[model samples]
Target: MKEFDIIVCGATGYTGQLACEHLARSYGSELRWAMAGRDMAKLRSIQARFEVPSHVQLIEVDITDAAAAASLAERARTILSTAGPFANVGEPLVAACAHNGTDYVDVSGDAVWIRKMLDRYQEVAAGSGARLIFTCGFDSVPSDLGVFFLQELARERFGAPAKTVKGRIRRLVGGLSGGTLASGRASIQAAGADPKIPQLLANPFALVPGFDGPAQPVGNAPVFDPDVKSWVAPFILAGMNAKSVHLSNALLGWSYGKDFTYDEMIMLPGAEDADSAREAADANIWSNVVRALQIDLKPGEGPSEAELAAGSFEMIFVGRTASGQEISTTVTGEGDPYALTPRIVAECAVCLTQDGTTATGGVWTAAAALGEPLRRRLEQRAGMSFSVA
Candidate 1:
């Protein structure tokens, strides 16, 4: 009997609907999956709109209801969640999945919450065989996996790992999702309530508990890169992505090197212009002002299909070996980050269910848990391209 191969826990949300649409289009009859949320009517409505296979189930369960979440977790081999501002609604499902030995994936980029999950559930999930992976979406996947891809090449070409890798966002044309904004607000509130939370957020090694490597480059300031020939500014997701990369390095027994150094920034195209350089330097401050005004999208709101279709992103990773041999690669994708995230999250869950990774349970990053298998899935199954540049 085919129970659900995967369960999408927030199927009615904007991103959730995109995931369902992708699953319906890609796997229809081949995969047994379900749409789950607190509202049966909403789930059923989304189910009808997607034209998924008749076998696709609709599950009604509130994140707040521990029993319902646990029961749902027990029925599926993997649970892929798009629910976020995860600090509020994520723990119960993590607890349920850890206890049930069911694999789980989420697109959350909340490092603070993720750190707590690692401390509380990593051992339990490891003991129970539940592989909980986070930041499966655009926020950290490209950054994490870009470094992974570079290190793999370094070992192949130079017969050694790259000691330093840089992730630079070349281009990104997309709007932020309301869920992302909400999460940002929640994180700020958390940091304000507890003074130490900001320190955790600022720590380059926050995710790699008990091990701190050498001092990392401060990517928060704008600087010119001689190699890339462009001015770079702090990438907003750098801190979170750095933590994920370091965690992956730790999980892989420090194969990337105990002294691995990573940083991320956004490339400023017109940086030769003095005005543009100044603007790039102040981008983070201006962004914060905008966010403080709370003038962004709300939950269940997002770009139109045309806008989503037109959006795209390109990321470049530059790897430098101990001997200073450098190699570069670019990861590019079509569609908005929000639109693409669902596919990424869904495919990750499918990879876990069908491929049955050799990785033992516990908290995992995309590169550490899925690695080349995920890279293949993204390139082959999703509309993404990765190439040496």
Candidate 2:
């Protein structure tokens, strides 16, 4: 039997490195975990960066090496993959875990890939006792788990769940990873490779059950009403986040509601800062330019420590129940969005492997695997918190 409780696959990568660092700093002596990747030198360097116990092993394995991957899977109770543009290489690791009964999580925002994986290996994971979770990062955390929190808040206040839940990025200033950009490019490339892939990406109900509606473009509108306190813009993250939360609702059997509708927008502080809201609108322009130029901030290549220290984000969610009662919540995290995502992802990995509170033997999401535990953990440990407003 393997000695470690968890394996941080792709540990040489940016986010993976951060997870390793976090684990070493916070849970090193206690949690039996290892760093894994195809590059043994890089893994050794990563391990050297920290003063982890000698017992923390380093496993060499590539996603393409089926036997090595299976051996890697067999060595750990759970796997945390930071490998990106996951559509290309994610399947192999997921498949290996499914075959080996090892739990898994990844910082993938590729909903299309996730849907395909669930369709292909959900049963395998269930039978093998592996609990697979995707979108364990900032991409879906605020949105996926935020919606879950909103529904709970709504039910507590209005005696029922919300019919429409809106998640808007209130204030955000952050960076992106080369890995994430690569994933996006790969997704686009894969979409181009197969014309049907675009349609799959646009499928609203692709992962959600009974969601047969047409796809709506992200960030298409701006308005305000009584549900929340401020104006709303097209929430750029809504496309992926909504699907994740909805899928969880579907898999959890209407915990949120069959009529549950989710949209994301940017929240203006108080309807008084049109300029700031417009600045928020123009925020992703540079990211778009970077994507176009194929320029990415790779591992150890992100914003300086000073920049990360200065960056922060705020998200507000408004929920309206069937009875017309309303409730609201906010999720705020300080530091660079890209940087913080890895921290959340790492903590989520730790929670999955060490928390001992999640369901067993199935594919899951942040909302399903950690759920309330995640919310509290983020609040208590990950510099994120949620509260009614």
Q: Pick the candidate with the highest lDDT.
A: 1
Candidate 2 residues 1-389, lDDT tens each?
A: 56678888888887788788777877768888888887899888878876656778888777776777788788888888887668777788899999988888888888778888988998898898888988888888878888888887777777899887777776787765667666767777787889887776666567864467433435564565345667666554566777787777877778877777777766655455556555544455322333333555553466666777788988878787877877888888978876678778877877877677547777788887788877887887678878786
Tens digits of per-residue lDDT, candidate 1, 238-260, equal 88889999999998889899999
* TM-score of model 2 (CA atoms): 0.90
Where is the poorest 10-residue window by lDDT in model 2?
284-293
Model 2 clashing residue pairs (backbone): 85-183, 219-234, 235-264
> How do the predictions measure up, each by TM-score?
0.96, 0.90
Query: What does the lDDT read for residue 182 in candidate 1?
Result: 86
| Candidate 1 stretches greater than 4 Å from native | 273-275, 281-294
- Model 1: residue 10 alpha-carbon error in angstroms: 0.6
Q: What is the C-alpha local distance difference test score of candidate 1?
A: 0.85
Which structure among the candidates has the greatest TM-score? 1
